[model samples]
Target: MFKAGRTAAPRTRPTSMKIAMIIAGTVIFLLLGLPLIVQIITAFRGPFLPFGVSSAQWGVTNFITLWELREDFWGVLGATGAFVGGSTVLSLLMAFGLAWITVRTDAPVRRLISVLVIVPYIIPPIVKAQAYLLMLSPESGVLNQLLRLLPFTGDVPIDPYSFGSLIFIQSLTNVTFPFLMMVPILTNMDGSLEESARVSGASWPKTLRRVTLPMLWPGLLGVTVLTFILGLGSLEVPLLFGQESGKNIFSLKLWTLISSSSGQLPQYGLAAAWGLVFLVITTIAFAVYLRATRNAERRASVSGKGFRPSTMRMGGWKIPSMILVTIFILLTAILPLLALLWGAITPYPVAFSFDAMLNRTSFAAFGTVLADPDFWVALGRTVVIAGGSATLAVVVATVFAYGIARSRKTPWVKAADLFASSSVAIPATIAGFAMFLTFMVLNPYIPLAGTLIALIIAYSYRVSIAYRSSYSATLQIRPELEEAALVSGASQLTGFRRVVGPLLMPTVMAVWIQMFILGTNEFTLPAFLAVPETRPLSMYIYAMINPRSAQLYAPDQGAAMALIFTLMVFAIGYGLQWLLARRAIGRARKAVAAPDLTPLSAAPGGGGEDPSATVTIAVAKRRARARVR
Candidate 1:
């Protein structure tokens, strides 16, 4: 097959292109990462207000402030660690077992189970808190109400506000995440890699321990880091579900600083300092995770193999295990909606019965909202602010992702990737608080002190990682199609519009919708950045949650609000999925003009199809081809 040909040396690109890329990357990093850096710096703002953005104030004042209430502060931090650890361990076990069952087994009803598992994750956190409250409220809880009706054991309420309940709810709500993470890796893994270990007489547990565990350790590390950071930075579930009864996470302690009645004027500096401390813990975790996974590489275990994945092969564990998992799902996802609908229809101090089902469907739950101008103002503000911010973030992310994927030949691409992904390590709370501090100072320049601009920047930076990941995949499609149009006399912009833009529309739309849902469901950032004039729904819900307000049934009001929020999220998700399907059909119809090259196998040794044979020639050829490569 050798032919006489002269190969020319590769052409070199101009140095200016690389220089331009480097500058772009540096600028992007500075923009996203500067706030965290500033938080660390501003902690030294020296026992004073206005924590000036100067090196002079960059001392240890804030860190010391944390220890001033040494016992309480440290105790809360301990509680934070406990919450993170318990939740992490539980989520890991749940995810691992569920992933194994769904991926490896012929678990009956697997499809429905998989979908239901993710449903709770989509439920708003406040909604979850409300449902738990209804069933576990100290005195008039549904559980207590039921106990009273029983002939025996009627003396007490279940009281699920302890550290135990906090762990239970946080862990249960997060199990869906690890399950989602494992699916892709499990699917892409080669069956053969596991087979080799099995053939060498490894028992199932041994195989998992020595072979699969080692290989999946990187993923485990990544997931664990994410879970730990999430819990450490958490505020909602613990704040609402935990009692002063032996559990107080750092986030709660920070809340005490803000909302504790005795404080003179809001001490932004101390709260910011606490936020900075939380950021420090997460930063250390991120650094450790980066180090641990630094050398981890993808290992493919199977190619063409006769080995079918082993099914769950449940001997006696089926029914009991099903009962356990079902109970959890029922409580977390199913009960929440039922409870929400019930509370929305019922008045405050609700007593329960099957007869309550016969009560009139009240528009009153929504009626309260109708009379309140703030409700529509908040809803309209949510649409205009959150919706617009999410869209802009996606656009910026798309451009940023394109710069990295297609234009990485420029020096700035590395910087863009680092900044975009680095946002993942910075929780929304820290970013929001950082911006809160930064805005207070920068307000002089842009008058951003109380506007949506501050919140928008915080939200965009926080959600940029999702946008970058989604857009990066779309950008990796071949550029030759666009280049051909340009060469055919189309302008550069026209070529992108005609070629690249159409292909990216699916991901662009998806990122927009997903970010919108994430933004709306988000509570913590809005708590910090959203104010009375431009408040979001989460903050509105927060006001209702406080017992001091005229509205004592805060849980019911929030549950009603949350139910509406959840429907809005699903509407967006379903709408995007439908749009994506339609786009695919349209593209397929238009592809009739393109030639089909089915006769030629593309990849080397991609061998012909096997019409028959338990042991096919195609497998041999494919294996041989892979080995050669």
Candidate 2:
């Protein structure tokens, strides 16, 4: 007993875990960050060394001059910041309301409503913007035409290029993030927490403010920080909707540096400088968010168990909720879809009227875009890239999650879990840019860089955290089952196949489908990654939308393509969700139906309540608020 495990040094265990999380964190940081490092290192490696021989001279001279000369850089930075702040606030507000509607009330078709709410983001922003342009562009857009028809419009100039309009558009694309972010939080919360508050003379508003919000703080912090970084870093929304408003943001500025035909030496150095600045700003923000969260946790832990989630019976509000959710679903899911459909049918000669909606010309553009070879190539690239990446990510996350969640004594195993989850807070664009630079500098020998493989790697790395979270939760399932199989002399792989893998298969499928849909919509990464030969469909759509491109940006074609993509991804995601739901519900049904295990009577004076009754079902499924506490 030279070293009983405890005496062997607990320090090594946590240190190993820390290293794993740190490596994972570092890899994520490299996704967007390492590019600037590579860029700087490359500049220094050049004949005319940047900074100096010691690498210290790579400093302010380049940065100050560019910062002085490039007004667009500053404008883009400001616009990104403003849009991120504005959009994050607005989207979270909407999400809270919608979350409340679906989670708290006995809203009819609640799951359907929730599904439809998320459909907006599933459609590419490029396609979504195309539809909005058709509906709201000041000249021929549907909204503009309708506005002009009104009696009071003679003096009005309804520009879609307004600051307010840009903010509104950005808000729409981002609303889904908060919705997605809040789902797990809301669903896991125990209702008894809120119920306890309600029974103690806490008015509804008061209970929500005093009881619910504190619990939601972590999600709010995490989501807000994520939104801010994306907002600050994103160039897509501003490029499309904010362009006319003179809203040049960092992402767009980066695009200009890389894409514009500036006769010679197109400002790579300056772009690199901006990249570094952005990375610094983002890093600082991340630090602050982490600090804020830690502080909040310290405060909240003191009163942690005060409020539990409880359901509020909607005496008369149930039908009204159904009606409201139906309208919301219609507005978010149906109306834009209707626009796409109507746009698709009008053929041959495009007309900008209600009658044109039926004109035959709209159909031609759909045919035109689809028949284009670029469309097929881009679409094919998307599938291969997303499919390959998501699969790898799921596998890595499964291994990592299993090791960490099941670990009895190992430190390194826990580290992997911590690292995998940390990447969630990092913005995708940063990760994309970071990977771009990383490849440029090192292991350029590998065929993966800047090809479809490069895209896969980036997507896989960014998405790894997501799968890790989902799988880690799932990995908590009893390992005893698998151990028993091993004890029965089953082979390792056999035990995995007959025991562990079967149980995890449904969850792994869910993560895979989800990652695929998300991977398809990663518009920015592809923009940077696009070569003439291997351009992703997302970039293809953006090119189509460009005023300069020959590809059709006509509403009918664009919306049709958008809807096609949306429906495709929705089918994949919902398919997995349905499978998971069936498995979970069947297990739940069996658990509830167990004859010997009598649950506490939910009736007055504690009589046994029917397990299958609607009220009990509602209570049973009501999201717990334990996390909130």
Choose the strongest candidate by lDDT: 1
1-629 in candidate 2: lDDT tens per residue? 57555544446345343345345445444543455566665333432223322533444565666668777666766776776778778778877767877776666677877878977877766667666655565554555565677897863346667877777667766777788778777765666767778889899889788878877777678777887776665556667766556345667666666555545445545666666677677777777777778765433422356545445677787877667667556545565565565555554224365565444343566677778777788889988988988886776566545545555656765555544565554555555655665665454355566688788877786655555655565556655555556556564445544556656776787778778887887777777666767777777766655766654544455556666766766776677688778988897798577553444344333256554453443333221111111
Superposed Cα RMSD, model 1: 8.3
The 10 consecutive residues of candidate 1 with the worst lDDT sum are 614-623
Location of the lowest summed lDDT over 10 successive residues in candidate 2: 620-629
Number of the top TM-score candidate:
1
How much lDDT does each candidate structure score? 0.67, 0.63
lDDT of 1 by residue, 1-629 (tens): 97879988999755443444455455445447767665655566744444443534556766677788798677877887788789988987888777776676666887888888889777766666767666666564565676677786656635577787788777877788778988666655555567788899988789888888887787788888887766665667766777475346766666555553555655566777877777777878888888888877644444465544545466577777678778767767876677677676766656666575567446476667556677667767666666776776666565556556766455555655655777767766677677766776676676887687666666766546554665576566656554556556565445544555666777787777777777776777776667777777767776766665565335556667767767866776678778878987887686443343222224234346444431333333332333223
Candidate 1 clashes between residue pairs 3 or more apart in a chain or in different chains: 21-411, 21-412, 22-411, 22-412, 44-57, 44-59, 190-302, 191-302, 192-302, 193-301
Candidate 1 off by > 4 Å: 1-31, 49-58, 143-154, 191-202, 258-262, 302-310, 355-363, 370-373, 407-415, 482-498, 551-555, 593-629
Please give each candidate's TM-score: 0.82, 0.75
Cα RMSD (Å) between model 2 and the true structure?
A: 8.8
